[model samples]
Structure formats: structure tokens, C-alpha cells
Target: MNAVSTTSAERVRADLVRARSARSARESLIKGLLFLAALLSVATTTAIVVTLLQQTISFFGEVSPLAYFAGTKWTPLLSGDQQSFGVLPLLWGTFYLTGIGLLVAVPCGLLAAIYLAEFAKPKVRKTVKPILELLAGMPTIIFGYFALTFVTPVILRDVFGIPVSEFNGLAAGLVLGLLVTPTIASVAEDAMRSVPQSLREGAYGLGAGRLQVALRVVFPAALSGIVAALILGASRAIGETVIILIAGGQSPSMSLNPTGSFQSMASFIAATARGDIPQGTLKYETIFVVGFTLFCVTLLLNAVSTRVVSRYRQVYE
Candidate 1:
């Protein structure tokens, strides 16, 4: 009996060792796959940057950097008479649309997030969350068409009596705001949800009402993530192409008014390419320069978001 028991114990120990070894091998394979995916993402970004820089350098070779930067007009193709290439107008238009988009999206999205996270019951939240997420999944072109037909004419013209143009920045910005609202709402809600339940309970224990607890405790605690969400939404608004291309006018104007017609950087690229600008010409290369600028702006926003999120990460003992 003693001998038999010893043999069974030895067999069980060997089986445990083999199971641990298999688990370690599986973990190592997962780690390798994750590392490879990260490397591929970096490679893709580097390739795109390199390609844009190469084209922009060739463009600068044809058109002097001073002419490209300081020129007031942007008439790249002028009916065999005169040509100009300035990017300031496009930059201004891009910022104008982006600013308007933020104005509309931020307030609405933040409020929605606050309501859902702090106030809503579980049943209400479950029903509403999916509906909001559905907005994010909808195609951007549908928003563009809505802006062109339903939103622009009806709201801007008949309701407000504002002189609505066919391709106005206001409509584009408003529609873009709607498109980005879901993203901000989802991120901000997640941030609010991450706040410690203990902090909220303490607030309640101190004779604080639900509103006071949410406003004074939860909102402040989640400020960093809220800011991150706003930055991310702004980045998405800035990089948008189809909505701006369809609703924003082809004319790149340096105007601050959302009511005015303008062209964003993405719209400019689409418009310039539509014309007969040769692939190797200065006009064509200018597209890359604009694209590079857009890329840098979004990259900076993402970096700021990363730092903010990292700094505010809650520590546990």
C-alpha cells in the first residue's frame, strides 16, 4: 500500500510540471504575437511618413520654400496665365471647421456622458449605450449627404433665415460634430466609470447629495480622461475628409466664420488631385506636404493624450 501511494504521488507531480510547461509556452507565443503586431504598426507609420517627406522634398525643389509658405494666393492652376501655391488658407479653413465641430460636440457629449455614468440606472444605460455606439459605426458619407440636403437648407435657411450656401463650413462642422459625439461620449463615460466607488460613497457619507458627489468628486477625478477624450475627438474632426470634401466648398478661404464657404486640408487634397496636376508636378507634391502637416497635428494631440492618461493612472497598494 505505501509503495502504490508513492508511485501515484510521483505521477501527479509529473503531470503538474508538464501542464505548467505548456502554459508557459502558450504565454510566450502570445507575447511574441503582440510584439510583432506593435512592430508592424510602427513600420506602417514610418513608411507613410517617409513617402510624404519624399514627395514634399521634390515639391520644394520645384517651388521655393519661401514661395510655398509666404504666398498669399493659392491658385495652383490659373488657365495658363498665373499660378500661386500658398497653404495658409487651407490651414485656416481646417482650423475653422475643427473649431466649430468641437464647439458643438464637446458640450453635448460631455453632458451625455455625465448623465449616463453618474445618474442613469442600469436598464437605461444598457439601452442607451448601444444606440450611441451605433452612431459611431455609421458611415461618414451619410452625414455628408444629410448636411448637403436636409441640414443645410432646412435649418440654416428656413429656420434661422441665414443665407446658406451650397457648400458652407457651418453645415459640415455641425454634421462632423454629430459624427464625433459618440466617440467622446464613450470615452468620457469610461473615464467617469473608472473613478473609485469609495470616493463616491465617502461623498455620500458626508451628507452630500448625488449631484454634489458627481460634480465635486467624480468629475474632478475623471478630468484627465475627459480631456483625453476631447483631444481624441478633435483629432478625428481634424483628419476627416469625406464630410469636409462634400459639404465644405472647394475655395480655400482664410475666414473664421463658420457660415462662410471654405476648404479644409483634406478637401484641398481631394480637389487638387481631381484636376490635371501631373503626379510629379509641384502641385501634386503639395498634397503630400498638406497631408504631412495634418499627420503631425494629429500625432501631437495623441501624444498629449498619452501623457495625460499615464499621469492620472490610479495607484493601488
Candidate 2:
């Protein structure tokens, strides 16, 4: 009996050891994969930065930095007298479209978020939210076509009597606004929904109306996330290529008019990249210079978003 009992105890100890060892091996494999994923991400970013810097350095050798930045004309692809490297027009068009997009997106998106988070019933919220988010998944080219074929001619020209060109920024800006609205609405709604229920109840106890509570308490509490969403939408608008290329046209304009034809940095990069331009040319290097500038701007916006979220994000127990 003593020998049998000792044998059973030994078997149990061996089984436990084997189980733990197997678990440890699986954990080790998962940890290694996670580390590799992180390393790959870092390596990819570093590679992009290095490539951009190399090409941009080459570009600046031919073009002065002062001329590239300060000059108001952007005709690098043109010949002789028409070849100016001023990036301001592209920058202006980019921000002008972005501004128009924000004008349409912010109020509509915030209102939708507020309605979904604070006013809507569960069924309504579920149905509406999914439908709204589906806009983000639609192909951008489709949006461009819609703006060109429908919004520009029928809506802007016929209905509104706006003297928009066949390809103009206003229509593109409106559609771009529609494209980024889902992002803001979704993110801002999530932020507002995450606010503690007790806070809402406390506001109600103070006889605060639903609108007042939503605008005052919840909006303020979720401001960090809302701002982050806004920045993200702006980034998306800035990076949009196809819509702007198709609807906004390729005309680089120094004027900040949304009703006329304009070219954005993204549109310029997209249009130029598809051509048969030879490598090592000044025109080819312009792509990388503009791309690097865009990358820096986006990186700065992301940094600001991170700072804002870290500073003001409310932590609820």
C-alpha cells in the first residue's frame, strides 16, 4: 500500500511538471512573436525615414531650401521658366481642402456622437452607428466619382448656382468631409460612452437637461478623445489622393479658394508617381521631398494628439 501511494504521488508530480513546461514553451513562442512584430514595425518606420532623408537631401542639392519653402509657385514638373519649386501653393491647397472638410465634419460628427451617446435608444444607436461607419469602408475612388459626376455638376452648379469648375475643391472637400465623418463620430461616441454612468446620474440629480449634460459634462470629459478624432480626420483629409486628384484637379493655386481648381501635396505625389519620369531627376526627387514634408506634418499632428490625450484623458475607476 505504501509503495502504490508513493508511485501515485510521483506520477502526479511528473504530470504537473510536464504541463507547466508545455505552457512555458507556448508562452515563450507568443512572446517572441510579439517582440518580432514590434521590431518589424520599428524597422519599417526607420527604413522609410532613411529613404526619405536620402532622396530629400539629393533634391535639396539642386533646389534651395529657401526657394522650395518660401516661393509661392509650384511648377517643378514644367520646363525652363515655368519650373519653380515653391511648395506653398500645394500646402495652401492641402490645408484649404482640409479646412473645408473640417467645417463639414466637426459639427455634424460631434452632433451625431452626442446623439448616439446621450439621446438614442440602444436599437437606434446600434443600427445608425453601423450604417454610418460603413461610409469609412467605401472605396475613396467611388467618393471621387460621386463628387465629380453628381456633387459638382448637379448640386453645386445647378442647385446652388455656384460657379465651380468641372473639377473643383468645394465638391471634393464636401465629399472628403463625408468620408472622414465616420471616424470622428465613431471615436467621439466611444469616448462619450466611456464616461461613467454615475456622472450622468449626478448631472441629472442637479436637474441638468440632457442637452446641457451632454454638452457640458460629457463633451468636456471626452474632449481629449474628440480632439484626437478631429486630428485623425484632418490627417485623413490631408493624405487623400484620389478624390482630390479626380475632383479637385491638378492646378496648384496660391489662393485659398475652395470653389476653384487646386492641387494638394498628396494629389501631386500621386499624379507624378504614375508618369514615366526617370530616376535621379530633380522632378523625381520632388516626390520624396513633398512626401517627407507630408510625413513630418502628419507626425507632428499625431504627436499633438498623443500629448492632448495624455494630458486630459479622464481615468474612471
Q: Evaluated with lDDT, which candidate comes out highest?
A: 2
CA lDDT scores, all candidates in order: 0.87, 0.93
Measured by TM-score, how close is model 2 to the native structure? 0.90
As a TM-score, model 1 comes out at 0.85
Task: Give the Å shift of residue 305 in candidate 1.
Answer: 1.3
Worst 10 residues of 1 by lDDT: 72-81
lDDT of 1 by residue, 1-317 (tens): 99999999999999999999999999999999999999998999889999999998888877788877776677776635477878778778888888888899999999999999999999999999999889878998899899888788998889998897889999999988998999999889999998989999999999999999888999989989899999989998888888888888788788666777888888888777777677876677878988887888888989999998899866533
List the lowest-lDDT window of 10 residues for candidate 2.
251-260
Which lDDT value does model 2 have at 121? 99
Give residue 34's lDDT in candidate 1 (0 to 100).
96
What TM-score against the true fold does each predicted structure earn? 0.85, 0.90
